[model samples]
Target: MCLNKITLYLLLFCSCINESYSANISEDGSFQLNGYGMVAGDFQSEYNRPKNMTLHADPTGPNQDPRGKMGDLGNSFWHDYYTSLAVTKKWTGIGAPEQWADYTYQVVGYGDKALETAQNYGRFGGLNFLPDESNIWAGRRYLDERINVFAYNTKEVHIDSGIGYSSKNFDFAVGTAQIDWSSSGAPMAAEGSRRIFDLTYRLGLTEWGITYVKELDNPLGTGVQQATSFSAKYTMPNYLGLIKGQSSLQIQYGKGVIAQYLNTSRISVLSEKGDSSVRFTVDGSISQFEDFTVNPAFIYEYTKRDKSADRTTVIPDLAYSGGDMIYGYENETGIFGGVTVKQNLHHQNISMLYEFIVNNTRNKNGVAGANGNAYKISVGPALQLDVLPYIAPLASLTLTYAGGDREVTLLPKASEWRVGYRMEVWF
Candidate 1:
């Protein structure tokens, strides 16, 4: 809610500029048009071994390869298209004209998808009742408070067709969405909808928020499904020539219907019950460590389930490669530590990350077994370049490698390597 002196100056300077593009103007010439379009795509390759499967007789099932059927395979170019339009006007009674009221509409598409596809359309709109003090809007959008500035926010909660209100010190939203066990595959209508709520406040140097999700009729009959997040962030000014620093702590707890997904193709068809999970994460960033920007993060997670809970429920987001491994839905706990560093080289940015993960499966009595203890290391490197100044021509490449020791009936030991490249042009 606070703007530094330089930002204030920039705002003041921009107010004096006149728009060169205007269409469908109102009688008072207050209406204007603006929009941007972008096309992007990426290609990737992965190599790994098949797990718990034999070319001869397979007990786990058919077509089950622990290392992957294609030990090495190339992914096709996945595409994305995005565009947005906005209209704004000044309300004399509401103070500043530019901040008075505005509306926005956006649409995005995937590879080979039709433009009119309802599933591809993303829309939002808002009416400012009191300039920046209060507003209301609805649509599918990300509305979570992101505390980590240096990394992609994997923790931001997403919602659909949600209404929200923002004031000087507080922000909140509520919405409903279909319950899906994973982000992939077609969702089933057999289950009831889930309701989402989020509220946050800013006070002095820290911001805090709580997010809750509830299931109306959880298929698992595990009572009302609930996941709650309590989080806080503290920001400090820069010192010793480094940019300002930020630290964040977040805790998440979930009970009842818990769904777990791994990779993109497979779905653990077994519906799990008596699922409960807890997770704590600490993330911090130092904008500059000498010539490199360093961001460090740590996570501790634990999940407990009934004897019948599938082992997959205990797995965390393991795409990063080096973090601890949680193989299945047993009672397990995991700890992860990682650091990401970015440095500017010539006109490009080079970034690298390294992570260490350790996890163990424990019984109801909290006794760990060697059969379940696992460890892993993950590494990733990436580079981005702006080859052309016009239309924001850009290209990037990333590589990730992960390997570790895991005790599983299937593929007790497995590793993965992936390389990907992306290209984009915008206007």
Candidate 2:
């Protein structure tokens, strides 16, 4: 029960359940309610190896797991919780519109195990004729918007019930999805249904988008699976001199099926190539100092898959799968950079943040020094209070440090250090 008294009794039981659910919301007519909730606690430390340090060449293969190394060390603890709720209604009888109409209903629930596997229902309910140009109804939502940090970003779609169309620049949506590969142990695949489409275009600070997916009936017999994604973004405000720029680009193409784990015979192979990636990023921001603010960014990525002479097989060592070396089926190219700084004290309700990142990987079938690099840093301080008047409370604490090598751990080294805490309350 120690661990700082279980993190101070889970932060006083999540601030007494957000002050008893903040008096069950609902105020001022025309039906409207709001919500937000968050809680986080984390601790991490890494590096731990010994026990024959092996990737098994049959030194008892069945017991091998632990070679995603990169500065290895270990220790961990976690806690997470999320909540959201929204309800809105505005309209007076017949013909609805005359001025601002509304329709909304939302719900969300989350957990990190413990609330007995907590899981809540409905999230994203809709209906609006001129609700910002157009609207429809849906259940889950966050329809595609490509952004990546570590692969898997073909415009992350998530829409259960869908329909959309917007104006004042353009936006569109169409959906259907329910794909679960059972935690992706991927014995081929299971749990299926997919169909989604997205499109976007915005002028003025520039924007562009596209998304498509169709993966019907995939019990992993293959059969059907197609993906496409493209994205673009641009911004420039007071360019150069006062700095304020932004850039983004993304691309993806696919034909799915990936699951490589032949760790010297723990076996699990299912390759059916055709995967691609190209990512780009550029960032900027500078606020002529005063209360401080500076942001910077850079990123580049290139991923690939679709190489095989029957996907090789002939092992007894020389292992390293998925990022390959399994007889040669590799891919990876990255270049990352980051910087973030924010400062605002007192008058701004306290705030401070710092971040840094650096990564350089290369292993497209390696051989020239096989490149590798990694770096990360974080710092934090935050406090926003407004105790009552619909309550508002927030807290933060962060510290992080990361490590690298073997192009970020293809085993042979690793590192980690993390400390986190977060609390929030809102109405």
Candidate 3:
């Protein structure tokens, strides 16, 4: 039965594509196609040494012996390709407006199909429903608007769709998604499904601007969850010559029942089982200085089980631009970087950056100190190239050394080095 359904869907998709192409050829002179391709490879290694400690050491450890040394290595590679084609027409005879229509299709294939270990390699096409003020009827009324929707369907289709009125700042959207482990050749206890309703309101309060969003989610075989967020920004009046640019402050806070599937199994043991928890997040940014900006944020998360435990974090980031040596630094209490620097390049559009990161965390037992505490120092050189017509290339190389207490049975002191390179092309 599943095979029959799949065959029917594929046949329908091909028929629609052929019909659309034929109609475009009859209405327009020609069509254009464009796309890009990329391939990447990644390699990782881990070295761990345990110490003689408790009897039932780490279950995740390679061996039952807590005082043992182990090493692991893994590598993966993947490729992605995408293409888009569009047909356009010009109005000449009757009283008609110029119009254009496009249909894009993309597919990605991979060698390893494992959900956690497999590499992603496809470009999902977006839906664009407006070119020259076209109209479509949803239920009964004629809806004349612009619509854009994008989704990723590797495991389950995660969709984000919305319709805009163009003249007014009001929009509404509904989305549904399902995750099937069978697609990835994996066993599943039960299939997961999610449905969401989103409403956005944008209002112009005199000179200030305000935006509000309400999101509600309903999961299959589960209860409903909802969240509300609001943000407002106002530009202060420039009375004197103290401030040059606009200074604005924004705040957002949301509290709701977090979806059980959204939690990671590695983070919480109860994540695999059906468990409920309340979560809240409050964060904001402030632009007070003309050339300098400061952003401080905090988060407190708690989960309930047989016992309740909570974790809190604070981060402060400072950045300064329009200077000889641009400085940017961020510190996440004790766990992340405390300082960083960017030295200007000589004669070229290149720069070098140096950063220091410290991570510290404490467990509920208050023993073994913090599980994921470490210190990392990173230095990298970045180059920005504007080679030809409307094309720019950015390349960077970074090297980091992470050292600190490791999670071993008894002696947990290990250090490692990592080197990475990144390149991007934009047009």
Candidate 4:
């Protein structure tokens, strides 16, 4: 709201009209206020039936196959509460520590209300000062704010804030911004704005970047109103030399209003006249390993729309009653791959988890759910407090596989199981 009233009148004129510039701010120069929260609950059963499901999952099962993920596509299941908040400032020795400032806020909701879903780093925050080795942030900054949508910020559109800069005289450069909205208070023009140009370099284990996203203003009869995107992120680290972690690759391409949120573009124009999308991802990690640690991920996505986009039966003198279920999708494709293993079990707090997944989906027009191939198997045990596992309480046992898709029909096509307990944490 007007940038929170101009940051509360510049913090009330810098603590009441600056008291000698407040000792140039430094008391060992470090401050942080961080937060993350999780509270989840779910119970379901259908196999020898009796558990009387509640709060979700296993409707026709395979976790209802792809509903734009968050445990769904992977079938891990979470029921509610995911949040993050942050506050920070830096300046040490009363001099330069690459001055910094931070403010971040996030919202997530599911059952029983936690702000009823106003997802992701909304009203994000930032402030940086360092005219040397990089740091000059002014408004809108994004790089997957407040994380978690199963990571990789679900691949781009930057998010949105506005007015930004990076390359405090270059150090390989880094500048970001994000804003996306369709609802959840003020922000119009269909609510999406992206303007970015990137340059990053680091080689020793590989690190590369190429980014360009330009989306802004749109909404007059829709046929297109600014849209373009390009992305490339590459990283490689120790794997074979000893497997100390890190592996990455991401590729993206979009057009016309960033092509339908790619999943949640949040809107701001372009629904037809050539919509498009392309995506690819590869995840990483393999941390040392003695007790165990390994991670892997892969994703691929493709989307296309413009087969005369937008429809609700296109009003034929209007007079329908569920008559047109909107069977239109133009095209969509997906593939997922996964592997996760962790085992420390003790002194490090506790952990024992294993997972395996495989997925495939396709649609050219399917009534809002299910397509094909799905398999996920998770085994779990976790207990860690505060630092690392964040909170605690977690139990897992999931097995899913429903490869029967004649356009989905009660996929009791075999394997399905879930042993649950919620309460996730990450800090």
lDDT of 1 by residue, 255-289 (tens): 44222211011112222346656666666777655
Cα lDDT, all candidates: 0.39, 0.45, 0.27, 0.40
Q: Candidate 3 residues 1-427, lDDT tens each?
A: 0000010011112112333223334425343222212222222322222211111121211121111011000011121111112222323323333332233332322222211111111111111544333321111111111000001000111222322222145444344323322211112111333343333345662121222222232222333323332223332343122443223333322223112112111111112122233322222233444422332222222322222322112111111110111111111111122334445555266767555544343331123233555455667776776343113455556676655655312223477665645443322
Q: How would you order the candidates by TM-score, starting with the best?
A: 1, 3, 4, 2
TM-score for candidate 4? 0.29
| Cα RMSD for predicted model 2 | 21.8
**Which candidate leads in TM-score?**
1
Segments in model 3 whose C-alpha atoms lie over 4 Å from true places? 1-43, 46-157, 160-168, 180-191, 203-343, 355-372, 387-391, 403-413
Give a tens-digit lDDT track for model 4, residues 1-427: 1111000001111112222222223455343333345543335433322121111111111112122232322232343334444334443333334334443333333333334212122111232433444443434333431112223344332324443334423222123333333222322222334345554455554544444444453333333244454555566775534568877676766665332243222333323436677877777778887878877777787767666666322111111111111234446666767677778765555577766655566652323564665555656666665353423334333333323343322233344555545454333
Report the error of model 2 at residue 313, Å.
26
Instruction: Output the TM-score of candidate 3.
Output: 0.44
Extract clashing residue pairs from model 3.
Answer: 335-358, 335-359, 335-360, 361-370
Between candidates 3 and 4, the TM-score winner = 3
Comparing 2 with 3 on TM-score, the higher-scoring candidate is 3
- Predicted structure 2: clash tally: 11
Q: Give the lDDT of residue 18 in candidate 1.
A: 38
On lDDT, the stronger of 1 and 2 is 2
TM-score computed on alpha carbons, candidate 1:
0.56
For each of the candidates, the C-alpha root-mean-square deviation to the true structure, in angstroms, is 11.1, 21.8, 14.7, 20.7
